[model samples]
Target chain A: MEFTLIKPLFGGFLLGLAALSLLFFNGRVAGVSGILGGFLSFKKHDTLWRFAFLAGLVTGGVLLLGTFPETLNFTLKSSPPAVMLAGLLVGIGTRIGSGCTSGHGVCGIGRLSQRSMIAVVVFLSSGIAAAVSIDLIFGGEI
Target chain B: MGLLMIFLSGVLFALGLGISGMTQPEKIVSFLNVVGEWDPSLIFVMLGASMTYLTGYGFILKRSKPILAESFSLPTRRDIDPPLVFGSLLFGLGWGLVGFCPGPALVALVTGYDSVLIFVLAMGFGMYFFEGIDSRFQRGVDGGAA
Candidate 1:
């Protein structure tokens, strides 16, 4: 029960906070997909907003860690080669789709963007399938 | 100021990914394990994101006008369909293969990881490719926003 409650609660909290900050201070949704996507066709001045968004992402993580060192740890469960490939592919997919799970699935859907809503559903289902394939088909933990 | 705000937000997001160990592929893989020796740290990654979004969005919506862009860029669709399912599958497959996503990849970029660079490059290319089809679909959908 403890694990269940805290897990979703914190997930929701981080998302809610990020979303609000973008909406208020920046006048945007904290959709990583859209933000990152814009960088592809970006001009020099366009880099500013993207940079700011990325900076906030990193900063928020640091702030949380600094305040609650007790809640931090560094661990993982994938091979180096596999990890690299996976990273490469996701980077490609996110760019092509113009958003990731957070941007499309979380923010886009919340705002009810037709593209985002569809995108989220696709990515989330893709994610679940990815999980299944890694665990089942691969026969090795991904 | 508007542009600056976007930069700050990105950095904060990167920090979250780096500090929470989400940038580490091993950690993500372990969490996805769910069977033998399941490491639940991934929960923290999710928690970190949820927290930031919850508080960040909650406070921002109270403002009279948007602080960044000319106006809010709202999504303009309201239906669900098959392409949605197919796209998600592709995304998930890509995610499971690599522990990095757009957010975490950017975070890893801060560390100057060679892998992150490759991933980012390919990801950018992918977006360019997909936007074509996306636009095509949009046209079919009456350009109302597909």
Candidate 2:
């Protein structure tokens, strides 16, 4: 197969393996938002593992930068203000919603949870609508 | 050992995201932009990840408990509440706008881009703000019910 298909499928399989490892070994869901949220809460016993995981995330990025720089290539299409707003919404929304793409889109769907199913539908629809609207408003510039 | 495994899991997950083109905001924006020039590559990412996770999860669940922890600490909440729907909607809007969900945004922090830094800081503040509001809201509900 071509590089395009290979990259996603390979990467996705890696993600699955990561999730499986966490659950099988630690009994924790490999949800980024939840991990970050818990870390922020400052619960002493919980913070250590969360911090380790986050540190590992950064280390992984550094590894990618050194080994496969092309994988990390991309320019931000949105302006600074837009990006900040998006970040805020992501933060609050994930906190209140109890999961993000990793939690709801990947793990949640995998577990066949009805709530996750509903959440995936809602977020996908909202994301599609917002993306289409932004593209239209910016005349495809954004 | 448990912490080490979790850390390794994070590394692996980040690697998957980086290799999958998820670290690129533009790729995600293009994927979400179905009306415009769309990219369907992300669908494969989801499909591959979910199918693998589903099969693996089934096997894992058959075991009585995790190796490190006493028992599985999975979410037990099943209710379809307002917070779930509205929060997801807001999250999706943010995702579509910037193409950086929590994981990718956090993973991209290694780039040291000023934009990524700003987005992460704002996201942290937003999470803190939500916690404050949610706690107060919960208290209000309890008081009213009492």
Candidate 3:
């Protein structure tokens, strides 16, 4: 394991803290898809909080980057275009499911919601299948 | 009360990603690749997450009383269904293709990967795809889940 338990522990810990804070003030869950999805709204009035949240997200990453320069290696063996297309499809899936895996898998699961559980299961199984199929059909073999 | 707990959860989850190496797209890509120059980052991440999970969930559970709230809500459904199967398939397909999912994808934006924009746009469409005039209600539902 190139990574360690402390990483996830701290990461999850931060996520939980973020969730708690949102709940305290906004009575909200910190699902990124929903927050990011809301940013397109033209109503400047309604978007302020969403914008703020999204801003915080970006800011958090920026802070991390500044703190940990070693964390920013951006090389992938696959083509960028291919990955982008994949991301496009994922966006569609997140839309169809009414939530992303994190919304469902992490926060939803953390809260123990039926929908989130179902969503997580679907996300995990589908990801595993996709991994297998990609290896089999394309010989990409991940 | 609920809002407070949720916010705390988000911070914790993000922290997990940051620490687990899941927040790192390269690690994720390597994990997905698994065959050629496979990156062992995934193992470390899972281990990192599992170790954290050991105390994390239990600690929350033991609290019996969550901060700012009476209790924590657990997942309602126990069965796997069609949506579960199909959605998982789609999500997986997308992840394999992009090497990015919701969690890592958002965090990865710090790197300014141009592809993150495309992914985020598609994700927006995905979130709104289910509703029409009742969209407000749906957004709330979606928002609540997040």
Candidate 4:
């Protein structure tokens, strides 16, 4: 497809705004992995905010689908097994790394955290390398 | 009131992911594929989010505590451990394989993509499994310290 700039840029602005809102009001970093992982270590008082945040996340997508379906593209290129394996790896890895794209990439980078900075560089580099390797193996199918 | 603000934040985050094309794996994969056709649009997403956070956090941190919460829950450890490096490497591999991170994957699941359910399930399992191992490791470390 053709390269388009506006949509992604605008979306980024919203993403930034979201992170800011979380920090400003809740004093919490808007990292998805951390939000989801907190339930595993469930504390009594901790459950409500996490659940609410997750519910809102799902609700947001549902609302967008109902209103502006064109805004999202639900395309899948990986097989079921591959996707599942990927999910498992992501889950374990993010927990071990202590953040995902949102945690490390967005919030971590925003705070200028040295640990986050290192994690971002390592993950981004590895991600790029893996993508290249996958492209080679799949013969550019992905 | 706290919960409501959090819920609203999640909605905003989800909308941003959807609008930024972060929900789409193909776009993510394209952005990652540096040697091949590279899509640099995601940089704007990172830039926008980071800039906003940079500014917002500046003001937010100046306060002694959050308006809604008792304190800010921020990552304090600065050390770069082995787990961080290896875990990040694995995370990258998986991200490249499916182009679905925790955030976008959840968003996609909500949008009626049944296939993403498998990924979510597997991810949950992965998280639990890691937790089990991590707790055990922590126990061993604590014992040694004692």
**Candidate number with greatest DockQ:** 4
Residue-wise C-alpha lDDT for candidate 4, range B18-134, written one tens digit per residue: 888888888888899888888987788888878877877888789998878888777777777787788888888888887889988888787567668998889888988877888
lDDT of 1: 0.56
- Which candidate, 1 or 4, would have the higher lDDT against the true structure? 4
i-RMSD values for every candidate model: 4.8, 4.2, 4.6, 3.8
Listed in order, each prediction's TM-score against the native is: 0.70, 0.94, 0.71, 0.93
Model 2, stretches more than 4 Å misplaced?
Answer: A1-3, B139-146
**Candidate 4's error at A58, in angstroms?**
0.5
The local distance difference test score of model 2 is 0.83
Candidate 1 residue-wise lDDT, A69-139, digit = tens:
32233333556565555654564465445456566655654554667656755664565566656778777
TM-scores of chain A in all candidate models? 0.79, 0.94, 0.87, 0.91
Chain B TM (all candidates): 0.78, 0.91, 0.73, 0.91
By lDDT, rank the candidates, best first: 2, 4, 3, 1
Question: Once model 3 is optimally superposed onto the true structure by TM-score, how far is the C-alpha of residue A28 displaced, in angstroms?
Answer: 0.6
Fraction of the reference Cα-Cα interface contacts (below 8 Å) that each candidate reproduces? 0.41, 0.74, 0.40, 0.73
lDDT of each: 0.56, 0.83, 0.57, 0.80
Q: Which stretches of candidate 4 lie over 4 Å from their true place?
A: B139-146
